[model samples]
Target: MTTTDLLNVRSLSFAYERRRIVDLWSERFDAGLVWLRGPNGVGKSTRLKLLAGALAPQYGSATLNGKVDLLTDPLAWRREVAWVSAEPPPFEHLSPAELFGFLAGLYPRADRARWELHIEGFGLAPFLRQPLRQLSTGTQHKAALAAALALGTTVLLLDEPLNALDEASLVHWRACMAQAAASPDRLMLVVSHEELGVTPTRELILKP
Candidate 1:
C-alpha cells in the first residue's frame, strides 16, 4: 500500500450461503474519487459498507491508516469515514434542525453555521424547521447529504447519491463532489450504476 493510501483491502471476500457477493481480492486504494460500478445484487453497496466499517468481511481483512482494524475500532474508524445511502434516516417527529443538531453533536468540532450553509446551498433552508418525515424524498436526501458532509471525515462512501435528485440538483451535486475530491487528504467512493457527471480518479468494476 502506498504511504498516502487511506484504505487498503487485501484478499477481501464475502459471501452469503456459499454465494460470493464481493470477491475483490488485493486492491490498494488511495485518496481520490473511486467509483464502484456493478449491476444490482453484485455487492456494490456491500463493498462500500465494508470500507465504511459498517459490515464485517467474511474473509481476509481491511486496514485503515496502516494500523487500525475497522472492525475493532468502529467508532474511531467512523470518525475518519462517512457513509451516505439513498434512504435518508428516519426522522418521524424530529425537525430538520433538531436532526442536524443531533448529528452535529457526534463530531466534537462540527460547525453548526457551516452545516447551515450547506443546508442553504442545497435549498433545504425552507424545510429546516419542518419535520423530516414530512419532507419530500428529494429534500430528505439533500438533508442526509448535508449531514454527511458536515462531519468532515476523510473518507466518504456514497451509495446511489443521485437517487431522488432532479437534473439541476444532480448537476449541483456533481460539482459539489468534484470540489470535495479536490482535497488530496479526502477520499470519496461512489457506488452507482447511473452516470455521475463528475469524473473519478479510479474505477473499480465488479464482475460476477
Candidate 2:
C-alpha cells in the first residue's frame, strides 16, 4: 500500500441467513477512483455497505485514516464516509429539498451550495420541489447522488449509481466522478457492471 492509502479492510466476513456473502475479504484503497466490478451475485453492494459502516461485519474491521475503525469508532468512521445505494432514497413523502435539508442536519460537513451545484449539473432542478414518490426512479437516484456528493466525506461509496440516468445526466455525473477522482485525499469506490463511461484509476473484480 502507498502512503495515500487510507481505507483498509482486514479479514472481513459477513453473512445473511447463515449463508456467506463475503468471506475473508480484505483490501486497501488509496486516493482516487476504484471500481468494484463483479457479477450480480458477487456481493459488490454488500462490500460497499460494509465499507460504509452501514452494515455490521460478522468478523473483522474497516479502518479509515489510520485513526477510525468501524468496530471501535463506528460513528466517526461513518462520518468520514458517504454512500449512495442502488435503491433510491426511501423518504417517499419528502421532496428533494426537504430530504437535503434533513440530511444536511445529519452531516455536519454537508454543503448546501455544493448540493445546489450538483442539482443544476444533473438537471434535477425541475424535480426539487416534488415529493420523492412522485419522481421517476432515475430522477430519485440523481437526487440521492446530489445529497451524497455535497457531504464532503473522505470516502464516497456508490452502488450502481449509473443505473437509470439519461444521457445528459450520465455525462455530467461521469464528469463529477472524474473530478472527484482527481483529489489526492479522497477514495471514491464505484460498484458498476459497466465501465464504458468511467475512467477508473484501478479496478477490483470479485468472482462469484
Candidate 3:
C-alpha cells in the first residue's frame, strides 16, 4: 500500500435482510477525488454510510489507516472523515456562525481563517445572523457544507453536493471541491447523478 492509500476494504459485503447491496468488494481508495455514480436506490448512500462508519456491514471487513475498525471507534473514525449530504438537516434556531462555531469546537486545531473563507466563499455572510430555519434551501445547504468543510478532515464523503444550488453557487462549489481535491492528503468521495464538473481521478459505478 502506498502512502496515499487511506481506505482499504477486503471482501466487503453488505445486505438488507438477505438482499445484497455491496458484494464481495475489495478496493483501495487513495487520496484523491473519487466519484460514485449510479441510479437512485442503487446503494450509493448505503456504500457511503458504510465507508463513513455510519453503518456496519453484514460481512467482510474494512480498515482505515490499515488497522482501525470504523465500527469500533466511530468518533475517532469520523475525525478522519466528513460527510456532507444533499438534504440539509434542520438547523431550526441556530445561526450559521453559531452552528459553525459549534462544529469548530470539535477540532481544536481547526483553521478559523479557512472557516471564515468558506463562509464568505459560499455567499453566506449576509445570512450568518439569520436562523437557519429562515434561510432558503440553497443557503442552508451552503451553511452545512461550510461547516463540514471547515472541519478539515482527510476524507470527504459528499452525496449530491450540487443539489439546490443556483448556477453561480454551483460554480463556486465546483471550485471549492477542486481545491479540496488538490491536497495530496485529502480524499473526496462524491455520489452524484449529474456531471461533477471537476475531473475525478477515479469513477466507480454501483449496479443493482
Worst lDDT 10-window in candidate 2: 1-10
Q: For candidate 3, what is the TM-score?
A: 0.89
Q: Residue-wise lDDT of candidate 1 within 1-208, one digit each (tens)? A: 5364578778777787888887856777787788888777878887887777767788777677676667677777777787887567656477778877887777665667878777767888888888878989888888888787777777888999988887766766887778766767778888888887888888889876
Candidate 2 residue pairs that clash: none
Alpha carbon lDDT of each predicted model: 0.77, 0.88, 0.80
lDDT per residue, candidate 3, 1-208, as tens digits? 5463578777777988888988887888877788888888988888888887777888777667665657667777777777876666545689889888877787555667887888878888999999999999889888888887878887788888888988877878888778766767778899999898988878988776
Alpha carbon lDDT of residue 153, candidate 3? Answer: 81
Error of 1 at 31 (Å): 1.2
Once superposed on the true structure, which residue ranges of model 3 sit more than 4 Å away at CA?
1-4
Q: Estimate each model's TM-score.
A: 0.89, 0.95, 0.89
lDDT of 2 by residue, 1-208 (tens): 5463488889999998799999999898888888889888889999999888778999999788888888998788878898989987878899989989988887889999999999998899999899999999999999999999998899999998889999999888999889867878888899988763867788898999
Worst 10 residues of 3 by lDDT: 83-92
lDDT of 2 at 12: 96
